[model samples]
Target: MKIRVEKPKRPAFLVPAVIIFLVIAAVFFAVHSFTETSVPLAYEITGFEGQVQIFDLSNHEWRDPRRGEEFKAGQKIRTGVDGILNLQVENSVRLRVKENSMLVNRECKLQKEVEIYRLGLDEGVIFGAMAKNLDRKIADNKAEFVVSTPQFDAKPFGALFRIQASEKADENRVGVLRGVVEVSRPGSLSGKGPMFNVRALEEAEVMEGRVQSPAKISAETWQELKEGYELLAKSAVMEAEQIDLAQKAGNFFEKAVFDHGTFFTPKVGYAGREFFKDPDSGEVYLETEYDVFPAGSFVGVYIKTRDFDISKYEGLIFDARRKGDEGFPDSFFIELKSKGSVLRKYSARGFLREWTPVDFKFNAQKPTLINEVVFVFTNERVGESKKGVLEFRNFTLTPKKDPVPVAPAIPVNVTDIVSPPEIQSTPVSEPSAAPSNQTSGQETFDEMVPQTISLG
Candidate 1:
């Protein structure tokens, strides 16, 4: 009885201290759970080829990544001269990094009501496609995909787009193929400069920290954008098929004009060129009208090849058709030139009003360097018509061996001309002064064709 009575009284602060400790632990657990839930899953590399290398933030080293490997935020990817990398994010967005590109994953977050992805492009081009209705899981859900560059940032709203950046030149270009892309300078995002909205089939450029006005995309750029979107669409369903198809398609686009060529029309008076997209089939093509002043004058368009090694390729392939019911010249010439001299000249005949596939196999003597590809139209072939419209698209170099069968190759005869003849018109110094006769509703030929060449 005496020992029980000797029990000491409990300290006043002990209970309160225990309660405070419990409250602090509860707060810490809640914050940690929130962070875990807010973090986004890693991006999955679906396919890659050539010298694609990845730099991991955790490892701090660049390593060759395999298909199906996961890439996390803070990681960087660099593609070599022939490299291509394909990635999938949250099953809703697909990205293709073109050759000689460097991309960095800055932020990726997927929450119950919102998904955010931000990427940094240091150099080269990247194609992106965001699936429509990505927020179908929740009515209030939203998604934001942004690509930041040295000069500008591109924000796409469930669209297909391409963003190119040149850190060396401090230039950025944004092109949209299917939807709208908001292009803004880095300072403009903070309400400094004006923002530009580039819509479907349009492009905008940013140089010297200024965003240029949006304009229609060129035929070559359109083809590049279309090919990239098609590749992503085809691979959306199956991962295994995606890897195989992406490699093959990547190789094809690398050598073709779609990746590193400049399509342009010479500053001549006889020809007017414009890019047209078919509303029905969604096919993009180059439409050219030739108005030969003299009965025998010639007109043409040129694609700068940038001296790509076509030794692995067998020949040239393209699609052409006559616009409307107008009769086209039976003789169409395709000349491969190196340095200003014609390397090989091939002539094709029998073009129909409907689209026809034309392929020309190189002769035994293939040039080691091909600087330009010219499509020449001579009024002499059409006799006294002296005027015609032609549509062309899908100009590519055929691989030496293709697994799938292609259209029957048309027989092309070699021409003896060593060089193209000079035009007989005075050069118009101003684009506005260009003849508006053929391009009434379209942009002037001089304005439509870019004077400076960009190798992809």
Candidate 2:
């Protein structure tokens, strides 16, 4: 009987095959778990009142609304009750999302040629420091960027600025502070929709889901908008004065005047105190002629930096033009004087009888706190040039903000960890929808978008 059983038929060897398959699957999963790379860039929440949930698609699910948390991309941050969030994106960009504001990433891509951030600004304000490269293009090419509101049924393009965008209904107002921006409205009048450069400021009212006719803002607001610009222009003249005074020990700061167009207004020289004039056509030109120092008499425009502490400022930037005379004395100079000494000086180059952007970084050493800045046009050369005219505009003094606190220190020792017995904040009451000057009926808004501003 034992011989007839044929050694029990060897059980088909199925057990070993099953064991081997399980072992291979386990090894593959173990390797895959260790290879995935997460984003290295971090984000910190600077300020927030209530518990806000920020959703990031890539990493994990949720982020604390509290201060000092890391943030990654595709994160949808929701404000709880009354929440104010200040998020620092990519280290250099600062984003402050106001309460009741909802921002969604429509599309964002970083490619070889350009980085595009298409964001939806729904019911709030988003302030950003555009990437330095974009700033460079704006300063160099005079290129203008566009921002639009999509949900509203008029035009896709909304308010555009250098790096600021705001959306509000009824009493909505958006403006450009330093760079060029184009506002495009839907219509056959393609060339229309105002083009703002430098200090060209405007605001439009949104009603009934449409941007309506612009309302007049007070001069106080206008002054506030133009304040930073005026100070910047004055600083240029102040720099020139410091150099001239140091060279000869005289009062040049007080006598310094903005020699070129300020805020794109053609500087009125050989005329009264007005630097430029605004015609109905909105064409600003600089038509000024003055005999600069053929041997360095210090001819330049001044900008006052009274309210701003530019000690940490990185540089002075602006656009310049040399027209009419092909070989005029366009050699320029920039100098920064601190206390009683000329701290820094930079000689101009690449003046090729065309409009050019000039960016000069200031030395990190203590600056003159530049109450005045000067842009010098020198005529001291072999040419028989006596008068030098160089038109300048779009001046900006950029300061580096204090390094933003990145991550909260993590405690290692058990004794160092103090569980902050979670203190809760008093919730603010949400206001009901009340009509004010800033809000208007939807019907009125619909009629306003297409209506042209009556010239009469």
Candidate 3:
């Protein structure tokens, strides 16, 4: 009787329809889960030093984060004098936050189609490294990665680069050690003005919404910045192996004239100074040409300025190179000047038509009045050829400051490249005015996908 009553109420269509709906729903969910990416919701703290503080988003509180603490999107972080912070992004990316600096995780949204990662530096410096072999072709790397500051924005495809925001000047400087970086001004996501590319050993300045062309930096000058950042973020064993304590650094570029000097070609032998950009790396260098060979005389260039009193500086730092020219002189000379020439000229080597970083230490006593600096090239050095193009940039007379610690060599290993769509940064629309300490030429940057400019 019970079985007959139950069977009488049952609908044949109802069971099948319900079962089909459940099957369809399960299939849809399984497909969606399979296509989703396994991205982390936050960056995990790896290491830290000094007095570091973080603003937690969940609790809305400022507190010290322990190792393995997570920094979510929009989390604010700052470091004190003794403060250094290290963080891991995914499995391949890393961040080193320097002392006396402030920054935030600007974006960490990984959607189905692509992911965008950004960090904002309000003041101070930060160094970042990313693996080169990232699978950019996959669906998640549309923006690649970027670091933004008060003055500019950097889209470093996969790079080792540093960002310094000067609290006083309200400007920002980016130093690239490896790979390629796209530099543009703030609010230029539309890439309003000319976009600049920076390569290894290059530095760019961003101020008042304009991007200075990239220029070469001395290895020591760069090391100071790079290693200093490393010291604050990582271990300080490498700092012990560096050069003398930094007393003071007089950046030749701080002045308007930039201590630009004359290339004395009194005779018919001529030389000219111009600025050129490397189309590939987007590096800027001052290009000077010695047109005709003149024996025992200089068709060279010099930079002398009374605007700066660099007496505190123990030596001068600059980078020089010769373009791919067999006609270029085999050697060049550097001179430092004051009321009287406290002359210790450095003989140029490594002029194999490539950029070379040189640190000219003072042989004599520090100059009494270092109001002038000079770089002289003459026909005396070359064996057969006297005419050539001299490429030079990064003229700084640094002072001796207290020794800063150095970081041990990081064991980051990267092999390969990343490729994404054309980012907001594009090539310069038109050639910028011929600027001091800049060079322009065609190089191949397009072929290298998802370039990384290493700060190290």
Instruction: Please give each candidate's TM-score.
Output: 0.47, 0.35, 0.43
lDDT of each model, Cα atoms only?
0.66, 0.43, 0.61
Count of clashes, each model: 0, 28, 35
Instruction: Please report the TM-score between candidate 1 and the true structure.
Output: 0.47
Q: List the residue pairs that clash in candidate 1.
A: none
Global local distance difference test of model 3: 0.61
Superposed model 1: Cα runs more than 4 Å off: 1-37, 111-113, 133-141, 168-171, 187-193, 235-456
Put down candidate 3 lDDT per residue, 1-456, tens digits, no spaces.
455444466778999999999999999999988886746467889889899999987789989988998888889999999899988765356788888999899887665645667788898888877652332422244535777887788877545678788755545788765456789887565668678988655788876767899987653535444442232222233222111111111245454133343455444345555443444555555655553343466655555566454435655666777654225666665554555554334566556455666775442223344445554566666555544566666667667666689989967546645656776876678867765752221121212111111111
The candidates, ranked best first by lDDT, are: 1, 3, 2
Error of 1 at 241 (Å): 15
Badly placed stretches (over 4 Å) of model 3 are 1-40, 135-143, 228-456
Clashes of 2: 28
Error of 3 at 439 (Å): 46
Model 3 poorest 10 in a row by lDDT: 240-249
> Candidate 3's error at 351, in angstroms?
18
